[model samples]
Target: MSLLENILYFQGGLGVLANMFLIIFYTCIILDHRYKPMDLIFCQLTFIHIMMFLTAGEIWLADIFESLNVKNDFKCKATFYIYRVMRGLSICITCLLSVFQAVTISPSTALLAKYKHKLKQHIIKASLYIWSFNLSFSSNLIFYVGGFTNVSETNQMKVFKSCSLFPINYIIRGFLLTVTTSRDVFLVGVMLTTSTYMVIVLFRHQRQCKHLHSISQLRTSPEKRATQTILMLVVFFVAIYWVDFIISCMSFLLWMYNPVILTVQKFVMNIYPTITPLVQISSDNRIINVLKILWSKRHQIFKKRWFFCLL
Candidate 1:
């Protein structure tokens, strides 16, 4: 294998491992109600991340090993369709998580607070809807995506391996692209607006606490910490997502002239999903405590071994 391909595979393998860790962590959170609504959403988000990573990993493998390639048009279409569906669902779920937290931490008298009572139930229903809608919408992809086949002048047939959207009627293609762009734009808009709202709410609350000389009271609250974590998640997600989007556009415009641009786009695209679990753990006291206990046990074992060696 080429060095670059090996590096790509290594990076993808790391992403798969990190996503697995997150899946386990989220599963622990979901099995216990102390974590509640947010944990449920986190679990779902982790699952989506795993799917995205696995699907992308498979594509990379197919690129490397001809035996693993998509052998037929149906497989190509299905692979592309599944990846797009998962990607769309990921965006929608993240947006939902952000908005849910924003509403959860809103002031009791605020209009958004009215829905907070049943937000847990709403989260379940929203998750189901997001999955169903994304799957249905992405089904449109099957009509235009497939493995390309070319026949050479020497009378040999070559089947291109990658899953790609084949060009269709211009109007139909444009419509599909428009629908996709609209969905992304809408979800991103909601995420930004809700995250910004939470920041404003947090700032105002901090100001009020300052006026009352109770800033410490506000700072110590779980809600305040969650607000900060979600805001940070949003910042990381937006930064990586838009950069990937721009790179994707550039790659398309350049049309195979620069392979490096597409590679960079893929790298950026995976950044958010790969690192999100670490972001979550950083702000989660429960997860941190568990990690500390595990670390202490490992450290104690190492110390005992060293003492025995000294004796």
Candidate 2:
């Protein structure tokens, strides 16, 4: 590989690491009640990130054409369909997570509080609905995406992959683009709105505690630290992903006029899924405690299994 390819491959490895951490986190959340409401969304997000990394990694780490040989129509269709569905679902889930988190911190009297009780249960149903929804919606693209053999006038020709839908009944292309654009707009709005709510609530929380000793408030207690970490995290994620999504939307929407925008968009677009794993490990005590608990349990299980074998 060239230097550029090497860099891409290394970055892909980091992406895998991020995805792995998310898998561990999702697994922990699944087995615990503290993050019950977040379990479904986090699990789905983790799975999506894993797929995103693995598939994208193939482009860099493996033979782009040789190893990824879309050997059959089925493989081609599956790859396109799966990636689109997962991408849509990832954005959708992140938007939901942001809204849910914001709702949770509404101080018990905000009108949004009324919906808080249903958040956990609603998440389960919503997750399933979203997967099914995106899957069904994106399935039509499969009919247009295929690996077909082509013939040329050279008297020596091989399979030349091309889209069956390009120049593509402008109507259908328009429709697909519209659906995708609409969904993006909705999710972006959700992210920005919920993120704004988080900012407001967090500012209020900090204002209330502003008089306390800085060291005492920021470092002395686990609860305060966790809350502080989460608040900071809200700010970080909202700033990063929301801006990314906005730039991406503008890029795609204006691609006809400026194609290079995709290059600008790809950096942020690709990394959004990488956030779930790195979320607060550097700051959030709750996540750290969960990781420690999981590590201890894993060790205990290994010891027990070995002891039983000896017996």
Candidate 3:
């Protein structure tokens, strides 16, 4: 195989491996029961991230074949659509998760604290709104994407370089990106700012509890560590994603794409989405404990079933 081929293969294999880890991590998270209801939101967020991983993974792997051969119009359009939708939703959900965490840690003086129940009650509604928003905004892309061959045959296809032919699709995509980017900046900013304050308050509260010796002055029994983990998640999401956005946007200003650079960029695109669930599982003691219990139960049940069948 050629150098470019080797790069592609390596990246594809690595992405698949990362995705496998994502699956194992997700299964463990689901099995763990100590995590409360909102913890499932973290799982749902990871689901979207996994979708992003799968979409990008397909493009990376399929590019090998497409290099020698080509793709069909339907396949091109479908892959393009799914990739865009999944990526869009993944970012949207990350923003939602950050907002949810921020609200959870909101100070008493904060207005949202008064409406805390609404956050709990309206999570489903909020998620639906996010999906509906993306679907509606991404509608135009359906008309604009097709196979390169089809575009060449019809003399109407615009080249987008990799997996499929896509027109600029810029106006609609830009509009959607604008909305999402604004929300991303705002929500991530809120999450980081608020989460930072919450951490400081928690530490100070810890010190206060340690210094004073009255039962009445005691802080809430043990602190909730979820806020800290969620903060780490937000920080990771923002720092990594912002770097991606900056690199992606720089492509326009630089207007240069060597196969090596593109391959590296593609690797970054594929790998980052799969890393979040592992981070959550590693960082959250509750999630880890719950997963262990779930796994033990599953193993015992499997053993019992095996014994019965053998008998």
Candidate 4:
């Protein structure tokens, strides 16, 4: 394989490993505590990350090994459809997560705070609704997507280059595209707005307590830490998505000839999923405390064993 292809594989491998870690981390969290609604939703998000990486990774591998035969039209369409749905779901869940956190940290008398007690009760229902909506929305992609055929002398597949979109007339295609784009735009707006609200809440809380503490004495509140984590996730997600959006628009206008755009887009999408769990571990005190406790216990055991052996 070429250097670029080799790099893609390496990145893809790292992304898979990251997703695996996210899965394991969240699964342990749920196992330790009674499976909370947020935990379940987070687990769903991680699962989507795994599937998203797998779907994209498959296309990447297909590009790498030109020798592998392309699947039938159904598989091609289904794969892309599933990928799109998972992607949409990711956005929805992120937005949901932001809103959940925002609600959790809202002032007692605030309108959002009213739902604080009720949100968790409906999280499962809300999540199911999100899945259903995205699934229905993305079902259109299957009809538009076609199989990869007409391989060139260089053994490059058309699907690897660019999968066909809405084979209908321009007007119909435009309408479908607009619907999907608007959906994304709306969800992103929700994520940004909620995240910003969270940051503001943290700022206000910090400001109110500013007089009581010196600069060195100030510590990060769990709410503030969680807000920062969510904000980072949202910022990373929006940046990657908008970059992908621009690249996709450019590629479409340019006849999608650029392999580099696709590679970069895949890489950008992987960044959030790969880094999110690490960020979570950093922001979450419980996880860090557990790790520290385990490490200290192991060290003590090792010290005892060493002393016994020396004696």
Q: Which candidate number would show the highest lDDT if scored against the true structure?
A: 1
What's model 1's overall lDDT? 0.75
* lDDT (tens digit, per residue) of candidate 4 on 94-152: 88888898888899978888887777677878898999998898887576567655434
lDDT of 2 by residue, 199-256 (tens): 7776766676666645446346454444454445445555676676567445334433
lDDT of 2: 0.61
Prediction 1 TM-score vs. true: 0.84
**Please, what is the TM-score per model?**
0.84, 0.71, 0.69, 0.82
| lDDT score for residue 39 of model 2 | 56
Per model, how many backbone clashes are there?
0, 0, 2, 0
Superposed Cα deviation of residue 63, candidate 2 (Å): 11
What are the per-residue Cα lDDT tens digits for candidate 1 across 96-184?
88999999989998999999889889999999889889889889857756665542322211112354545456577567667877888
Pairs with steric clashes in candidate 4: none
Clashing pairs in 1: none
RMSD of each: 4.9, 6.2, 6.0, 5.3
Estimate, for each residue in 38-152, the C-alpha lDDT of model 3 and write its tens digit: 6557656666665665555465535654675755665566666767777667666766676676576666777767757677556778888888987776555677666654434
Off by over 4 Å in 3: 1-35, 59-71, 107-109, 149-162, 165-184, 213-223, 252-258, 290-311
Q: Runs in model 2 with CA error above 4 Å?
A: 32-36, 57-71, 148-167, 211-268, 289-311
- Top model number, TM-score: 1
Per-residue lDDT value at 71 in model 1:
63
The 0-to-1 C-alpha lDDT of every candidate, in the order given, reads 0.75, 0.61, 0.62, 0.73
